[model samples]
Target: MTETLARLNATYTEHVIEDFQKKRVPVEIPLCLKEDRIAYGHNLEISYPLKEVLDVSYRYEPGKIGFLYIHTIQGVRTFQINSDPAGFVEQFHQLDHL
Candidate 1:
């Protein structure tokens, strides 16, 4: 993550992983939960009863880059990383531009 994104999260509210209107590769941007500075790689998860991860680390590899956020819903948050990071970003942008 860039410093800008980190800063943005700090100065805002809960970042939402929003679904695009055209609905291709969904892209989500996390916002701050409060107007406080959220540090890099800070863990912020929510729970109703059973405590679990609401978001995981966003990984970036030579061929792939992705943010994995897990929820109690289990199957709902399960997916595969079948492409490189550049490819993934391009594909997502293409879907958004469509």
Candidate 2:
């Protein structure tokens, strides 16, 4: 997760999100099959920090509706309140267990 956050921070640090927030509307988590960690929807929100990192931890895998978490950057943050449930295989086909 630290590596992932660093990659995001490098490309989308504080300044980037500040510009984005100003130009666009805020929305819930953007569903994406974007990375090995996220392809299964097991990973969650991307943090965009402006100056400081508050904390980082895995609250859950984020495969349920109303599941929410905070991503921070300095003084700014975006809440991703997801409202989607995992599909049968769509959610677990990749699992090494089961």
- Candidate 2 local distance difference test against the native: 0.30
Cα misplacement distance, residue 82 of candidate 1 (Å): 15
lDDT of each: 0.30, 0.30
Find the 10 residues in a row with the least total lDDT in model 1: 3-12
Across 13-81, the per-residue lDDT of candidate 2 in tens digits comes to 122346457444433234332223321122445423322333322222446423322333434333333
Candidate 1 residues 29-76, lDDT tens each? Answer: 332222222222244442211232233223445454433322433532
TM-score of each: 0.23, 0.24
Model 2 CA deviation exceeding 4 Å by range = 1-25, 39-65, 68-79, 88-94
User: For model 2, where is the 10-residue window of minimal lDDT?
Assistant: 4-13
